[model samples]
Target chain A: MTSQFPSTDDVILGPGDDAAVVAAPDGRTVATTDLLVEGRHFRREWSTARDVGHRAVAQNYADVVAMGARPTGLLIGFAAPADLPLAWAEEFTAGVREECALAGGAVVGGDMVGSDTLTIAVTALGDLEGRAPVRRDGARAGDVVAYTGHLGLSAAGLALLERGVDGPADCLSEHRRPSPPYAAGPEAAVLGATAMLDISDGLVQDLGHICRASGVRVDLESDALRPEPALLEAVRVLGAPAGNAVAAARRLMAVGGEDHALAAVFPPETGLPEHWHAVGVVAEAPRGSEEVPEHPVTLDGDVVERGGWDHFRRE
Target chain B: MTSQFPSTDDVILGPGDDAAVVAAPDGRTVATTDLLVEGRHFRREWSTARDVGHRAVAQNYADVVAMGARPTGLLIGFAAPADLPLAWAEEFTAGVREECALAGGAVVGGDMVGSDTLTIAVTALGDLEGRAPVRRDGARAGDVVAYTGHLGLSAAGLALLERGVDGPADCLSEHRRPSPPYAAGPEAAVLGATAMLDISDGLVQDLGHICRASGVRVDLESDALRPEPALLEAVRVLGAPAGNAVAAARRLMAVGGEDHALAAVFPPETGLPEHWHAVGVVAEAPRGSEEVPEHPVTLDGDVVERGGWDHFRRE
Candidate 1:
């Protein structure tokens, strides 16, 4: 009201009370949030402001898709240094708008604050169109675990970048920007997936979430992983320790995060699309097992000793 | 899901999707978000981690109330250095929990990441039951402007602290932690407030927002403001620049922000609570005015310039 901006009737109570009532015409709403920090979550040297913005929106929207919801709107809170370039901010906003459009959503409102470093926080809202949310705790003992979208590629690319290895541009591109299988989440839900999640943090770690939530053990077959060859080739080219690379790739496929691929557990006999590969199966925990009740799937017939990324532990 | 956490049915879809869906039994949800950055927003020396947590929740929740909604839940995204004490993090969460209880909400979810400095982002959700939102774009000519909650105390306290003027403990408390009139927001909405907003930036600037949005001009009668001898005494003690304490009070009541006071425009004949004071009137722009419109109300028998905090141009 301080400026000459035209007021809209839709904002019944704009900037005044306990909550802004956005008209949810469909009667159901979906909500997800993501936070991006300087250095830790992103590096200005590695990614441009636009790239950071796109990455931020893509990851959060992937979560919305994982929930089987159609993203509708987003609210952003941006914190940055007072001296930051105004153009950076503008381009960042443009990136968000572009990514939101890709995810079929609009940026509704945002707050900007001056901080010492750049940080972007985004909360996305969606509409379910009346479908029940598919949860991670619904996988049964006999469910077949399948995945949609690329795996190991992000981890392989990350390894290549970290080791300063030059590779085909594809590897670096994969590390810089991830293309999540956005539509596959709701599609899986409609396909009768009992339980599903987005593969961020690596396959093993993410699937461990489903297993622990569903109280089941999982057995993975290594032969089914087709991306291993490409990953191995990248690992060989990097000349870095192949132990961690092989282990990390398989581990990331099992345990690494940020790729944001869709993974779901469906009935054993459920038909899957070509993009989805049968990677594992759920099983009852062995009686009186000394290990954790939910067992992790093994790679190349070897049981993975570690779980996914733990914030408390240094990588 | 990786940790030993309880599974709740309330979290229909947790942590995997672009957005999470929760039950909204009332068919309406209230929402607001805020960003608090280190150095710019708060100095660690001036506030403890717990204080930061409390302030973050307090200010955002106040916005929710300003919308006339009941706080229900909150999701927080915290970015801090890895070396930040575990105890500090615990205490910070405790503070969030304490404020949530005070505002009648729960800390439903959050994201934590490592950053060079601490930053907190909070998104609060509320339920409106079934009431219309009171907006700032409804004030009409001849409407009486009133305010609930303390005004200028924060600015006064801040000025004292900035000048290193030793004051009574309560003055520092006001500067450190503001107690916004949370209930007044919904109360004003129910009372049929034509235009309303929380006085966050400053009374004058915020009112200017309402005026611009509602297409009206506001004029404050200086004599209507009560005596502020305490502020005068403090200003004198600090050897601050000379200004009418009453005029400053009037200006603060008009422009200064961060007090989070609720100001509402009502029909001139409407009855107000004992604590509420009628300070101004809403009217059309003055006649024969090229810049400002006709019908501008005379403040203290003269026109007063509008001023307040602007983040981009902060002093």
Candidate 2:
């Protein structure tokens, strides 16, 4: 699609200049950035250039939505080997354009450089429409913790792709391109979310951020999760330990990242969306607490291990 | 120094959420980004983490200043091997903070990720107090071209470092940390510059950008350059070709990138600062000519080969 604003008109000053000036509607702007490396973030064999671009935009946009903001524009930096096909670059831009459309934003500008491997760094800008920013430090004791997006779906999809599971093609696709519940973040804020975060890491890990920031503890009820049954099928297909499967799903719900799900703690009285589930409640930390509980999710009436991905350690 | 605003107060929302909201003065923001890779941009053996941080901030902030904007904040993304030292990260942050202070800005937020090699991506934000952004396309025929900031110094230092020629340690240090004429950008803008650009990609190459964009041609009188005598000393020490010294200097002026100098074409009658010199004049492209001149700058009354760095074929 053509740019929403003419190249000359949309940008008060275009890309060749030092900095770009974009129209800020509400006198406030929201900004976030993410970097994607070639082999580490994506392998050409597993993902097309378009897939890479889509994933990049989706993840960053997820962050904006999680803040209850609407994405406005994006600036991308791409580094690639000299030998890479020019077509790949064109396709990548197209993917960025498509994802920006999905996220209600535009690809305003970017820089391209030569590298031995391909890397993409993306910065997203957003608008809050004068609403107070919802932060992770505001969850209080007695708040209801709710999640508005897929829980273990991305993790399950990743497992299926890794183990070569054959049941559902869509699961593998989801692993490549996550469909975050973008609208849910702002909706949660509008509904009085006290604290919020994007579940890019894992459900538990991200909620843990809210817990630590807000100085509260979180308790999750496994039965309340809607995606458990679907995840179990993949667990069974992989013939993995049932405990590991449950832990993976729980950890993802609790720690699995990259889904870009928006999890928030709101006043207990606040109503939640149809897809959102009240998996837990925020409470004051217990006295003499030495460690945060890993498996806060109770399965079959017992707590289990919730091991999720960690950037510095093997998953 | 502690943050100017409390984490909760200044950030409105700290980093845990999807995006961040910082107060934008007068509802206008200046944004620019740059990516620096480990080997491509700098070698660990040649510079410390702190030096890398300073260089990264300097180049990006130069862009902001090049636009006649006052930098206010920066967001950095770092990708490094998992085993990298924590102290190195801290030092890097300190360098960024130091340079931000120099530019009158703060390090607002950033992201860290694990990668096979180190890469630092910086996005700088600035505020222009109601001044129009100076662009490269604004020059017209008969505009006088002038430069503020050091030229050929970094290139001279690079030649010494590349050839392993020992010199006063300051030359190498200058190469590692260029002191851009930060205030000159807006100064030129306020002085009624017709068009302006940062002299990062060598004098001739950068001016070429202005010429190509402004639909004009540039003619440079090299005898007017002030640093020629000093550069000749470094050239002699490096044992570069004797007949090629002038050509080399012109090439360095033409295509040399990364000096971060400010170059602008001003109205012919405009007075310039004492340090600023009349390097060239912009003129209409010659009739029936599809190609620009082979050498945009005439060195000592002769045309010379102007070659500068291109990432794809720099070496």
Highest DockQ against the true fold, candidate: 2
Taking all chains together, each candidate's TM-score versus the true structure is 0.85, 0.87
Summarize candidate 2's per-residue lDDT along B138-195 as a digit string, tens digits.
8887899898877776777677777667754544666788777888877887888888
lDDT tens string, model 1, B261-291?
A: 7888988878887766788888775541233
Show model 1 residue runs off by greater than 4 Å.
Answer: A1-20, A23-28, A228-236, A239-252, A288-295, A305-315, B1-20, B23-28, B227-251, B287-315
DockQ-based class of model 1: acceptable
Fnat per candidate, as a fraction, reads 0.51, 0.53
Which regions of candidate 2 are displaced past 4 Å?
A1-11, A228-232, A240-252, A287-304, A308-315, B1-17, B83-87, B168-170, B228-232, B240-251, B287-304, B308-315
Error of 1 at B50 (Å): 2.6
Chain A TM-scores, all candidates?
A: 0.84, 0.86
